[model samples]
Target chain A: MDIDQILDSVSPIHKDPKAILKSYIKEVNFPKGHLLLHAQKCEKSIYFIKKGIVRAYSNTAENEVTFWFGKEGDAVISMKSYIANQPSYENIEVLEHSCFYEMNHTELQKLYNEHIEIANWGRKFAENELLKTEERLISRQFRTASERYNELLKNHPHLIKRVQLSHIASYLGITQVSLSRIRAAKN
Target chain B: MDIDQILDSVSPIHKDPKAILKSYIKEVNFPKGHLLLHAQKCEKSIYFIKKGIVRAYSNTAENEVTFWFGKEGDAVISMKSYIANQPSYENIEVLEHSCFYEMNHTELQKLYNEHIEIANWGRKFAENELLKTEERLISRQFRTASERYNELLKNHPHLIKRVQLSHIASYLGITQVSLSRIRAAKN
Candidate 1:
């Protein structure tokens, strides 16, 4: 989709406001496995995925734990790091050759200050993110590993096809072996 | 604390804007154990707790799972229900005799439309909530049950004293027996 369409999908805005927002967004591309943001790095850019997939994960002492994936039309940011202007606890890596519309934190803040509609859009976006996070937390707490896998498959079948099994396993907070077994059982 | 002070703590605003916001806020009280919101109910009021604690939980077939707690100076809302105007998946209950400044969803939307500062405040509030929910999700995925319990104790010692052990266990996604064992082990 074009920038205008993407912006409209996020929140409707008038032509002048859309033009102002468009000025701040710079399109960029990255190859697969490209690290967009690293843990312990302070970066202030939020990316709107025009195409491709990205995975956000945290590295523990023993292993890397996948948190979530962002596909096309999704906004990818280390929210805590971006909001607090602190080092990120999670690393975001592109899993496929990607195109994104990048918005610098300072420019976005300016837009929020200048436009009430943008501020409202930001509120709605954050609320949606919170809701998705809450759903993930609830599933993790209440659903079994197999149940989670089933739900993931049912909800994001495309994701399962595109992403590696190990990454998906980590996202589910289960071992790859367990995931394999679950997959086998399903088959 | 008064409504003005609470609003100030969230994000500072000019006197006139503050007065406009104050007009929409209604102070109300609920006794301990009062069910402020129920699962599958579509209500759209966000409460800013002036005094006392509230718990948000979801009821599964097997048991009720406590998701999180909100104390004095916290905003309590079943956000998904409020945002989508759909039945909530979680229930909110008063754990202590509570006083709150309640703002209806429609009034909040109107305030956002009329006041840029209020919209900015809402954006900031939502961003903070997203940060918190992300933190909770990360901990749940990465931390051990005992580690989670210990973290809960260290961060929210007051919660331990105020709330039931059962609810705390539910929040940790552990049985009461497991929580007891973990507590004993820590001691």
Candidate 2:
């Protein structure tokens, strides 16, 4: 999808403002398994995925727990780290060979500083993300493991084929064995 | 707490911009048990509480599930409903007699449209909300029930004194019996 289209989808921006935002966005690539961000390191950039998948996870005492998946056309950032300007508690890794448009902190600051429309877009985008995160929180708090699995399937069926089952199990906060049982029962 | 101080803490704006924002805000009062928002009803306003508490929850087939508590200095909105311009899935109610500075949706849009600094502050505010929601999502996904209870105690010890045990149990995603057990174990 076109970058302008992605920006528009995020929040409509006029042609002139979109052009300015486009100027700051730099295209980059990553191989599968590459760690785009590491726990304890500060996040420096926000990425908009042009293609492929990335997983955000945190290393707990026992294991790595998957938090979310960002796929084609999704914007990915270690939001906590970026907003706080502190070291990240989570790591982000490419799950597939990925193409992205990255805008570093400085560029993002500049965009907000220079363009009111862009700033408005940023607010709307963050509001959208907040809503999504709240929904996921609600699901985790209120839904059964099977229900969460079904939700994932209903919302992002493409993720099932694209990422490993282990990652999905982690995201669902269920043991791999339990996930397998759920899948078996469903079938 | 002073409304100006709360606004400053959220994101600072200069005198002129602050005046513009202040003009759009209107102080309102709600008695305890008043429903600020209801499920299936579109949210019309965002509120900055100057005093007292509000609870956000959703009614499921079996029961009402508490999602969050917004206290003095906190901003409360049916964010999903406001962002999507649809009926809310959650309800917000005054848990205590409350005073708030309310800004309706159209007024918010006008502020964003006419004031660059206000739009920038809105972006910063949304980003903060996103980070907070992400933290809650992570906690729900990874923490043990007891751990979650401890987290709430650690972060907002005052809430225990303000709200009922049943509400806390709902927020923790545990049954009242389980919560009682957890509290007993902790004691």
Best by TM-score: 2
Residues B2-37, model 2: lDDT tens digits = 878988887888999998888888999999999998
Model 2 C-alpha lDDT versus the unseen true structure:
0.87
Over the stretch B1-187, how does candidate 1's per-residue lDDT look in tens digits? 7788888877778898888888888989999989888888887788889999899998888888998888888888877776677788878899989999898988888898888999988877877778888888888999999999889889888989999999999899889999999989866
Candidate 1 regions off by >4 Å?
none
Q: For residues A54-116, write the lDDT of model 1, one tens digit per residue.
A: 999999999999988888888888787667788888889998899999989888888898898
| Residue B38 in candidate 2, Cα distance off native in Å | 1.2
TM-score of 1: 0.96
lDDT of 2 by residue, A1-187 (tens): 6688789988988999889888888899999999988888888988889988899998888899998888888888878666788888779899988999898877787788788998898888888888888888888878998998998898889888888889899898889999999999986
Chain B TM-scores across candidates: 0.94, 0.96
Model 2: per-residue Cα lDDT at residue A108: 80
